[model samples]
Target: MNKLSKLALSIGSVPAWAFTTGIVLAAESVKVNPPKYSVVSVGALLSGLVSAAIIIAAILAFVYLVWGGLNWLTSGGDKTKTEEAQKRITSAIIGLAIVAASWALIQLIANVFGLNFQEGITIPEIQTNK
Candidate 1:
């Protein structure tokens, strides 16, 4: 296969590798402490994933903004290039604003529900008779 196809194949396999690794690690943990996996753990996992996604997106937005600034500086009186850079910067700013608004909305909902996003998830214990 060509280089582009090879690269695509490698990238496509990454999620499969991650999924397999996660399953293996989870199974090992279950073998060590079966009680650790519960509703609270799942909630905590979801929360962590969401936080990570937000952080990654914010970082990407900042990087795009910087890239646009660089492009603008390097345009050197070219109208088309300058306009493209301006568009990039504007889009990045808009994306950042949307992200901020979403974060605020999440915080507001969490507050209304009396939930702390920073805190670990709380799940009531269930009593089982052997």
Candidate 2:
């Protein structure tokens, strides 16, 4: 082989050798672990998720109402801008109402089903010999 060909082959092999060494080091350092969480049952997980959603919805509605009020104040007496701001405020109110209704519905369903939120939902576990 010519000198140029040998030089090119050496340069190409350097990257391959570096990548193989890096992969070996990475593989040796990697460790497997199960994720830790307080919520064990599916019901508990869902309850937490629902509660978070309700809080976020309420916060977003309040922010929307504030934004609409600001827009109205800065509208400079333009009729169209005022109308749009009014619509935005109205939509924010509707969103709040929907969130409240959903909460009530969830409470009603939970009551009827006797699902207690205080005590996390219990699910039966099946045992098998390892």
Question: What are the per-residue Cα lDDT tens digits for candidate 1 across 95-130?
Answer: 898888888998898889787767654555789999
Which segments of candidate 2 are over 4 A away from where they belong? Answer: 1-37, 124-130
TM-score on alpha carbons, each prediction: 0.65, 0.65
Off by over 4 Å in 1: 1-40, 123-130
Instruction: Compute the lDDT for candidate 1.
Output: 0.82
> Global CA lDDT of candidate 2, please?
0.86
Compose the digit string of candidate 2's lDDT tens values, residues 1-130: 9999999999989988876733343345667564665776787887888888998999999999999999999999999999999999999999999999998998888899887655655555889999
